[model samples]
Target: MSTETVIPKVEKKHLENPTGGSKMEKVPGKPFMEIHDEINDEGQGNFPLILDDSVETQTQEDVKPKRMRKLTSGGQEMYEKEVEKYTAELIHYRKNLYILINSYYSGELETLEVRLMPDRINKELSKYQQISEKFIGFLKRYRTAESAREEATQKIIFKSIVSKAKTILNEIEIKLKQAQLAKSFATGRKFKPPSASSMLIKQRAKMDAAKTNLRFASKEAEPERLQFKLEEEELKTKAELLKKKVEAKLQMELLKSEKEVAIAETEFNAVREELEMEGSRSSGKSMASVVDPRQHIERYLQKQQEIMKSVYINPQQMQPPELNVHAAPFEPKSEDIRQTNYEINNVSVANELSKFLLKKESIDVSFYEI
Candidate 1:
């Protein structure tokens, strides 16, 4: 048996086409969009890179959001310069578009200036697309960096350009509409259908007819109005006479009320005077009759002194009778003498007894038959 030689096996890869196809058969026409990548020094793309997808995602994550910034002097100057540069071409195309749309709505013939608006719009769009491509490339560089500040600045610039494009498009549409309206107004052509315009015209006619009828009606009523005015004047005269008579009667009533008020005032005064006189007379009589208590007491004391002088006699200086009071020591007798005739002068004996019994005192006695 002979030994077999070793063989190296090579694996083949079924590579797709350059345009993402299975084969190299070219498509019939240019595709709407194309993406190609050729190897570079850094293995980056040779064809236009698909930076948008990667940058957009990274930018959304890394970039700080834009805030409203106050424009600097330099920024303002730059903005003016940019405006001046772009405005000439834009304004030219805008004017042409305006005239075109205006005349179209006006039902007027199209001029050469107006006819060129579409081409101008397409050309501007192409130019904007080319600028956008460059702007997008700059944005990719900013997004790859880690600095949020620089990324935000780049984003602002990019957004400004895009916003400018949007504003231009919006302005174009607005101007077109304005031109259309202007043309319609100038030509007196109704923008709406005949039925709508006819309705408005009919409403205006109705208003005019109403106004005319009102005017004629007013004219026809003029004679009747004159008659009404004359009657009103006559009624006013009669009312004036009636008002005068009522005023005179009211004046007479007011005079009578005044007289009654005066009489009542006089009666009040007379009553007040009579009360004052009576009060004065009563006050005088009371003052004359009023006596002080001290004077009355003094007069009573003088009268008592006179009565005492009339009744009292001079005290007789009679010597006191010898009282044979035996002040011997008290003795208890064998038999108590029951003398019944006992006379007591309470004034003399009563004061002499210092230790008098504190009760109603009575004496009981009997005469013994001897």
Candidate 2:
């Protein structure tokens, strides 16, 4: 058989060299190099035949011509449409993926079990949901009538959608790999029931841990409980001591007040008794000699009336015999009685003056004058 030369149908993007000429455009799929390597591996050195197969399978129409059009030439509308279409596709894919994950978790997808740890899977799912929501939000924002007409804004939106789509694709691939691994593991391993020794060991470990916790709690809490009790007792004792001190102080103050009252009463009584004795001694001496001046005048009037009667009866006896009025023997002379009365009054006044004098000599001199 004649050997046929085969040529690979490369896209314009792929044809451009990265370093030699213009920058190579990044395609939104597997890299050309990787695809070629896979094909080479599958073909087993039959590169010419594989290249022919790839050329026949891929179509030139797969490249978007609308993407090459300028934004000024109605390209914005075409891009918007494409974005909408892609957004729908992504939504469908997200829904399917969610259903698939749910089925796997529920054991309905037995053939595609997930080997990822539960927490990791949950974290990944959350990230995927967040990204999906962000993507949808971006699409909705760009789809507004105002933003949809903006070519520059549309371009940015397209790039964002593509990046998000790539991220979602990567997450899906990871999930698929994990599922495959889980399935393989399930198939390769045989289930075996746990032995009685293992169950006993686990129960014994749990019992030991509980006992250790109990011991630790008792050891840690006992001193604190005792310390609390001691503190409470100390507080109570201090309160009692303070109460006793206050009571004793109050009792001492009461006793002191009582003693002061007793001393004051004794001093007042002594002063009163001294005043009464002075009054009693002066009262008797002053009262005895003191006579009413009115009674003396009445006696003189009676004597004058008797002399007038005698003159009328014996006119010849012009020189009436001198009338003799004899006084009581016990009565003292008027001058002497008056002097005694003055002395008694002075003595009473001197006794009170002596009490007010500060010096003993002054008190004695006042008493001697009396």
- State which candidate has the highest TM-score: 2
For 108-131, candidate 2 gives per-residue lDDT tens digits of 433334443333445554554565
Minimum summed lDDT over a 10-residue window in model 1 is located at: 361-370
The models' CA-based lDDT, in order, is 0.44, 0.48
Which ten-residue region of model 2 has the weakest summed lDDT? 44-53
Candidate 1 wrong stretches, greater than 4 Å: 1-145, 148-215, 218-227, 230-240, 243-370
TM-score of each: 0.19, 0.34
- Candidate 2 lDDT (Cα, 0 to 1): 0.48
Per-residue accuracy of model 1 over 1-370 as CA lDDT, tens digit each: 3222221121132223343432221222211112245433322232221112112223333343353244568865764564344434433433343333334334453444345554565565565445544444534443333223433544543443344334445555665678788887977854555688889999999999999999999999999999999999999999999999999987776676666556555654454444344334433222223254234335545765887898876569556678668867777653333211111222222222211221112111111110
Error of 2 at 268 (Å): 2.0
Per-model C-alpha RMSD: 29.8, 19.0
